[model samples]
Target: MNPVIVIGVLSGLVFLLLVSGTSFKPFQFLGQGVIKILIGALFLFFLNAFGGQVGLHVPINLVTASIAGLLGIPGVAGLAVIQMVILV
Candidate 1:
């Protein structure tokens, strides 16, 4: 019942499970979110690039990305409304 052995065994089991894909359920959810984040960020960037002369832009960062990722177009619209309210 040595502490070092216990730690080592637990670490090995974790590593094995991860490598065998048994621990991927949570990561799949996170991974899908990452894809959505990238997509949303790109969508925002596209809008800003195409509409910058009109003052249409959204901050590109983790929080915005996560919001857009989780909520899609509604999230972008919400951000736009908030930005307009703050700027006005």
Candidate 2:
């Protein structure tokens, strides 16, 4: 496995779990979580499509941390999925 990809995905997942714990009360914001996940996935998809052209070489750690910090766990999970897909 590519080290860059591995690091990206792992960091993303860790970010997700960490954010999940702090962001919400759990079980109550399920719908919001789903929406966040979808948005995160879309964000990553677009990032992959035009990352180089846009000069957004955003590192995985930074990206994940930012998303987890701002959007919470679900967002991080979505980003993690995209990162794994790209890496594989």
lDDT of 2 by residue, 3-24 (tens): 9999999999999999997876
Each candidate: what lDDT?
Answer: 0.83, 0.62
Model 1: per-residue Cα lDDT over 1-88, one tens digit each: 9999999999999999878796678899888888999988976787678668878778899998878767888888887788777865
Off by over 4 Å in 1: 1-21
lDDT score, candidate 2, position 9? 99
| C-alpha lDDT of residue 49 in model 1 | 88
Models, CA RMSD each = 8.1, 21.0
Superposed by TM-score, candidate 2 places the C-alpha of residue 73 at a distance from the truth, in angstroms, of 15
True-structure lDDT of candidate 2 = 0.62
Q: Which candidate is the best by lDDT?
A: 1
**Model 1 error, position 47 (Å):** 2.3
Clashing pairs in 1: none
